[model samples]
Target: MDLFDCQIIPVPLTAERQSHISFWPNWLPRERADALLERSIAEIPWRKDSIRIVGKTIPIPRLQQWFGDPKTSYTYSNIRLQAVTFPEWMDTLRESVERETEERFNRALVNYYRDGSDSVDWHADDEPELGFEPLIASLSLGAERVFQLRHNLTKQRLAISLPHGSLLLMGAGIQGHWQHRVAKSKAVHSARVNFTFRYMNGR
Candidate 1:
């Protein structure tokens, strides 16, 4: 797809302390988005992983698949993930994002939320391996969901409705200051797929 042919604009957010979040409600065409969602569900080797929280082992809410360049393994919440080869479709999409955002990414973490029961807790992408500042490009498909961000110190909050085919960019310093999550909602019964691309600093 030609970058010039696509008109993806960012959705503005209310003024919040040290927060950088923007969204393109329709980064991909509806047909393309649906196709990608179906292919992702069929091709990716998704699996459940658990994390230790407060001395208890609990399964992570959603299924995940981590794939990227060599040595792009990542760890967080005491869970380690090794990098696996990515599919051509994902690689092409990553290039498109880089061209539009003027940024580069070497790793991708995909999350699959099955129905309303699956969700992620509030947390920042501030792992040591991500460096002091991190830029995350998150693309959503299949279903719409609400993504919330809260300030680390000010207690201010912002919420955005992320629809299918949308792209959300979390800019530098955003992760250092703001925490975000996808809350579970009984109203949503369809599945959703989120692809978050990042520049991993790993061995």
Candidate 2:
């Protein structure tokens, strides 16, 4: 889709403050998106990472990998991910995203949801390493899913249906005041992959 086709959704943060989300429902054409989805599932080295919760080790429902400068690492929920240099295909995708969004992104956290049961819990991408008011560009491939967001203070919420090849940008300041998650669904049986592009300091 062209840049002018973007859908901007306003997110109210407070009485005076507001953030916004830019969504492109058809960022990539179906044929290309289908090929990418197949390549991602078959070629990428997906990792099975677990988190420690209340002294118990539990495997995360989804598989993920971090790609960026090899020197940079990301840690969240007690799981540390050492950065892997982006492969040629992924780097090309990143560059395309940069051009489309007109934003700089140096890192990507790619997640593979094998089925409906695979999901991510509500959380904010507010790590110190990301600096303040970070912009996140998320690209979805494969099955459609509901991306849910909730205000941290006011408890207000929003949900967006992310379809295959869609792109969504979480604007600045939203991370500080809101959390998002991809919840599990009983009816969805297909797989999905998401690439969350982010910028980091000292990249």
Candidate 3:
């Protein structure tokens, strides 16, 4: 992995305040971010394949991949995913997330979007396994992508670019109140990996 000279800096996430707990802290040194991303690609057990969405099993938006656990299999939006054990790098990252959210995470669900064509629709990570008032830590690495949110009923919108090394945290109430999505782009070439850490009680 190429070493970046820039330092990992955290991005401020408070622009306008909503009732839900949502945060975007991007402070990772650029170099460290590169190293962590490279290490993750090499060390994490990422897999390439298709998944069922809606009602039918379909291939991901593009050449998508994921790293998670067998028991972590949970599905929504026709997407079935397993939770993966945390890699050392991710474990360290998780600690930071824990401090930020003041909660611990046992499983991680990572998504890789190869380019602009790849994206996720507006959906909340409010699966049964995620528990009530779940704290989801989403860390972005690689290309910059837009993260969007809208009120479930009111249709109010909020959007931000989750550049490499940025972390977006949706704490519990956000799911009940909002739906988020990663919109498709037209210019990104490199891949973007997003790790959404969660705690599942049963489902």
Candidate 4:
């Protein structure tokens, strides 16, 4: 996709605060995206991590892996993910994302949604380890999904249909004031893989 083919979406954080999201509907060609999706499903060492809730342990709906400096670890919802060294292919993809977005990313959290039943609940990437006002660049491959966001105070909501090969950048401060999620839908039967690239200090 052309670098100019980006959509900037304004998100209201508060009466006096605002942020934006940058999205590219066709960040990668269909054929390339297809190949990447297949390869990722086959090659990545996916983990079925579970979380404890209400004194019971339940597996997350999707599989995931964390990639970055092995010295650093990320924890959220009581699940601690130790960083795995980035493989060559993922590093190359990260470089490409940085080039397109003009943002530095040293870590990535990859999620694999097997089908319609796999979903993520609303949450903010506001972990203290991520620092304040973290920026996230999320790339989607394979099936399309609806990415929804909701304001913290006003409860206002917005949804975007993310197509295969699309890239969406959650700008600074958005995570601080809004929460987002990929909800389940029976209409989506195919698989999808999302790569959310982020930067960590001291990495």
Candidate 5:
């Protein structure tokens, strides 16, 4: 598949100016996407993610792994994630995303939601290390899920069904205006993997 040859459609999820997001429902071919999903499940070292709340440690609903330059470290939800070298396949994928988006992304945060119960809460990617007006590229694989976005002030919400092999690009000013999350559902029995690429301040 040609990484740059995608049918990207603009999504008007928010009315705020300069807050843009685009979605490509079929960014990748089905066979290749399936193969990548299987390979990721087998080769990627996924770890159970946890968060610290009120001095108590609790496991998050999903598994995650960080890959990038060794010096690329991130802090979120009071947890620090040290970056590890990306595998050969991931490096190639990251390069494709960079070429397609024309954005320099230094790190990829891979999240695996095992079954329907695993999910992420509503939050913005406005970490101090991400710098001002960060651009994020999110790729979804495996099972489909509901991705929700909500305006911070208006409380307006938008729910999107994210399918396998889909790509969503969240542009500048989005984190400042909206919060997003992958809502959980009891009906989904399979797993879903998401790769979110971001540019950091120092690495």
Candidate 6:
């Protein structure tokens, strides 16, 4: 399997002056990955919640559990978030993520896609609490799912399959220029767990 490797190059996201680089490393082995996923499942209090979009609530099949600093507990669009102290396994993964992305994170929002049907809608993490151009480091495990990105202004689409134990980082003005989502798939029988680390500013 030819996965995308790390390279130092200036990524031209768009004509807009967005600046960021993704260093996707094959850091977590299958055994360690399973261990982390199982441990996180035990620690995080997963909840199934509805999201209000344009004054209408929608079906979001997955449950989310958050941890990190105590000041940010965002539940909805721009929902305020408070952090919980990190578990040891999470702390280890966080350190690895930080090293790969070269960004510091104070919080992590974890999502458990219990089956192939679970998904996240296309949205940008552009809340006031995230400040302007916040960075997000996402780690995927358990199953491979396609993560899609669309240009908010041009409608151009890009897709990448997120395999287990892989990481993707987005930062700078990328959030302002594009929106991303993990669309549903029907061929997989197992679940996938995604952990997105962010440094949220208290709104």
Deviation in Å, model 5, residue 134 alpha carbon: 0.6
Candidate 6 lDDT, tens digit per residue, 1-203? 33457633243467756555464646578798888778766767776677678998875688887787555466556443455677787888888888877788877888999888898889987777677789888899888888888878778777777777878787678788888998888987788899999887542
CA shift of 70, model 1, Å: 4.3
How many clashes in each structure? 0, 0, 20, 0, 0, 9
The alpha-carbon root-mean-square deviation between model 3 and the true structure, to one decimal in Å, is 5.9
Q: What lDDT does candidate 3 reach at residue 156?
A: 73
Clashing pairs in 4: none
* Stretches of model 1 off by over 4 angstroms after superposition: 1-19
Cα displacement (angstroms), candidate 3, residue 84, comes to: 3.4
* Cα distance off (Å), candidate 6, residue 101: 1.8
Q: List pairs with backbone clashes in candidate 5.
A: none
Better of 1 and 5 by TM-score: 5
The predicted structure with the larger TM-score, 5 or 6, is: 5
lDDT of 1 by residue, 24-103 (tens): 77789899999999999999999789998798999998999888865667888877888788789899998988887788
Give the Å shift of residue 21 in candidate 6.
4.7
lDDT of 5 by residue, 1-203 (tens): 45444444443435645456777788888998999899999999887767888888899999999888887677788678888898989999899888877889889889999989999999998887788978899999999999998888788777878899988889788887889999889999999999999998665
Tens digits of per-residue lDDT for model 3, 1-203? 23322223222223353444344545477897898778766766666656665767676674333334545576765556565555567778878877766777767777778788889888887877677767787888888988888887678787777878877666557776788898887887788878787776643
lDDT (0 to 1) per candidate: 0.83, 0.94, 0.69, 0.93, 0.85, 0.76
